[model samples]
Target chain A: MNELVGLSIGSIRQRLVDCQLSTVELVDAYLSHISSQDRALGSFLHVDADGARAAARALDQRIQSGDDLPRLAGTVVAVKDNITVKGLPATAGSRILAGYDPPYDATVVARLRAAGVIIIGKTNLDEFAMGASTEQSAWHPTKNPRDPERVPGGSSGGSAAAVAAGMCTVALGSDTGGSIRQPAAFCGLVGVRPTYGSVSRYGLIAMASSMDVIGPLARSVADARQVLAAIAGYDPDDATTLPHVNLSARAGQTSLTGRRVGVPKEYVAGITDQEVRDSLSATVDRLGAAGAEVIEVSLPTTALAVPTYYVITPAEASSNLARYDGLRFGQPSDRTHGHGAASARLRGQLFGREPKRRITIGTFTLSAGYADRYYHAAQRVRTLIRQDFARVFDQVDLLLTPVAPTPAFPLGSVADPLAMYQQDIFLAAVSLAGLPAAAIPVPTSGQLPVGAQLIGRSGDDNLLLDVAEGLEQALPVSP
Target chain B: MSDTTPTVEHLTKLANLELPTDEQAALAAEFRRIIDFVDALRSAEVGEAQPTSQVTELENVYRADTVEPSVHARTLVETAPHQQGTYFRAPAVFGGQP
Candidate 1:
């Protein structure tokens, strides 16, 4: 409990401001920790010690100057590899972009740096944020900090593991269908998947453009909020971003009293884990006791989220990933032994199996003759799923459900792809609805951490965080 | 008729991936399994629900064709593995042309 590594991001910033520690000292400590610890955990694709230290020094000077520093001043944060940091290798955890560097920092990265947030380094992820676990990362699989044998959850697996292992104060993760929250669940961290476009997508390599949302994974809900506050808001480059609003409630102001919380009956219907269901039920009861009115609601199309998302996401991904044709970024191989064919061979050898596989699946799904049969049909179903959530929201201010059907399953048990896809069932619907949801670690209730997902109305990001703070206090932190 | 047996090869080509025989077989099986699992959606009844392309009601936004600043060529080519006069060069690929 006295561990600074495991302390909340808010506390870490306070310590720095109180002159108890310097940003450079914090970076040095974490760099030493990463150098010693990251090999076993496989968290970062690259740990930029020199860059981080330089930034830390600059931040230290700012703190010393006693200028108006953002609340997250001197906090260490890790960025998912997909989000570009100028001069850093933006690999998106794929060999296709093994050492690609962007000319400019992603808007969010620039914002964090402006706020005096020290970017520790780039964390590993699914190849193009495509897989269910970091096992699919091009270079290495990020192991669960809790238990190395099990996955940290993905495609933001490394970011979650970084926070869980006390490697960073906060980490930025993108959720396109539970990528952020699921890993947070696995690693016992607070993961918030803000409403789509709440955070700028200007620098993030596109996975599913529509569903991709940037959020924070941290040691506590408050820590997540601090990082979110720094990064959340609009960038003119990303037209989807909402203008930044000062959300007071996100700092744990709003009460649960009279807040209509809905328990979607269909969510827990097929889930076999009695304990997971009981935990969610108990969360609802806890909220009710916290003075919020909890009601039972049904979303019949909830089960269809994964299917619809898989279709729609791959369609967009196919187009987005097409830019990596070996001409602009990454290593370009000889393409004309006889023609442009030889370079294709060289390029083919450079990318790993997963990146190649996803690009192919996306292409095939969006191809002629199959486009309507697959992508269009999925969109129609996505409509029903969206309407289902909208209908529920009309009756309730927030919806409660399990972040996942069960706690972290053993890593290797999900060998079957369909079973792995099924795991995102509870999450894809919220992504489809483009709603803000917070997954706060309810407790280790048992072996692994389980989180009760609080999905709020569109743009209700502040309210979602408020509910998360309430849940954080109501729920026991077994970690 | 598209044969599912070629799904692996097609996907590999489409994704610009070279899969070993073992991985090819694995991907084929996995793709088939997922496609089969979600195939049930095709049979579902949709009364009058129109195909929804995007969930958010926002319009497709665009800037007024304004010229934004771009990086200098030096910075752009800073990370390139090979560079020649005002261009990035690599191992030659063309046999007849080059």
Candidate 2:
């Protein structure tokens, strides 16, 4: 059973194709593992046991008839609660969305099902994907598999934890301001945040629409690449999706030869631990030794990312979250006791502190009196940030940096909102530029897992994943 | 700082949110700090550079204007907090029953 859980997607596919492992047996193994293991981790919110069994039975029957299956056939995948699955609960880790199940699957979810992968369950997240720690989740915080006392980095914390704990073969997580990568780094996994619009966000409950990107967190870069291939592409329903993106194709280069990896000096300028810095420096050395030219590149506007991101994200979030008024699809307030505005206020009260804080700040920033000073000014600064990335990419193929300042902090230790917001300082700039980035685990000064971030220019997702794989082969950190 | 930052009550009204009175003071303080942090954007010399709303080069993406099947009204409306005879119920704008 442990061997089955440890098998790579490539080997699993080969075994499944050879008829050595029945789809039912594979599903049963994961289901049992999750049933026993997930309780202490708080990784999964709801398990689709019957649904998974039904799908497995059908796949088994098809296999018995000597039919060929897709590469992802018989694989079990977990979904973050924000991404909708038909008839499954997607709470987005908020009490406001209680009892609400999406009527349809997200574009990615539907595509995964079409490719023969079975979704085992939906994982937890920071409520509305707002905070860096899962402690903000209304339900419960997901504990790090490395140390139960520490938090799995969030809003995609549960997805990362599930992968680390071997609860599922792979998990899908949404990254808005390092939600996926930070958690991936903290938990010792590879988390990819694809280029904006590379994957459809049709059924994802929007937090910050422009920055919200759905990606994979997996045990290995190869597995993350396969999962990205399965879900990425254009969708008619999502006009923002790129017209044609072949995320599944393997990059031609296997080595770092002739590749220029930029070390962003500004990314490490702020307060960071010695251990995390040492790990990043060592990874840079490893890349250089592998024949890639390593050079220091500066993103001068990096300091503006947090202020700019906070402004725009909230400004967008306020608008996107307005649809969750008590009337249509959220925790309902009794209308007979009040007027429309009052009832709406009551419904909004269902949200946790982080979501409320964001909504308030977003509303205030976009308010009539302040829009020009806050929203417009921030948007202009955002342009400068994007231009900075473009300038650096002109010098190097990719940028290497630390995923976060430090490894996983103890649960509930970082309480202040501003302190919590600082957790994504190294990552938010990448999202601001709408570029592709991946977080790969490396040895840390402390026992906890620390990740090194690899960032690429817009639409360079395939190359970025390839480079991440190259680094993975060179650095070789145990998952 | 107090004059520039919106009070918790004022922000709650604008955002259509409600917070308990006991927690409002602390939340208000935090908001003030965050707003102060955001004030740093004023330092950037944006000049005549146009603000970017979306990064994609694609603009005005349009489909064929064809109607397609959507989620069933019954299924969709079921997610609402209150519904009566397939119609979503909302609080009345005026002081009366919805």
Query: Which candidate's TM-score is highest?
Result: 2
lDDT of 2 at A32: 89
- Every candidate's chain B TM-score: 0.63, 0.83
State how far residue A439 of model 1 sits from its true place (Å).
0.7
Native-referenced DockQ of model 1? 0.44
Candidate 1: tens digits of C-alpha lDDT, residues A12-36: 6788778898878788878878878
Give the lowest summed-lDDT range of ten residues in model 1 chain A: A335-344
Q: Which ten residues in a row have the lowest lDDT in candidate 1 chain B?
A: B89-98
What pairs collide in candidate 1? A334-A343, A335-A343, A336-A339, A336-B93, A336-B94, A360-B15
Would you list the C-alpha lDDT of every candidate in the order shown? Answer: 0.79, 0.88
lDDT of 2 by residue, A1-479 (tens): 46787677777888988889988898888888988888899999999999999999999898888888987887789999999999999899989898898889999999999888989999999999998878888999999999999999999999999989988899999999999999999999999999999999998999999899999999989999988998899999898999978685454476998799999888867736998988988898899899999999898888888999999998999888877777788678866756556565665568888878888899899988789999999889988999888998999999999998889999989988888888889999888889999999987667989999999989988789888898899997755
Give the residue spans of candidate 2 off by over 4 A: A339-342, B1-4
| Number of the top-ranking candidate, with lDDT as the measure | 2
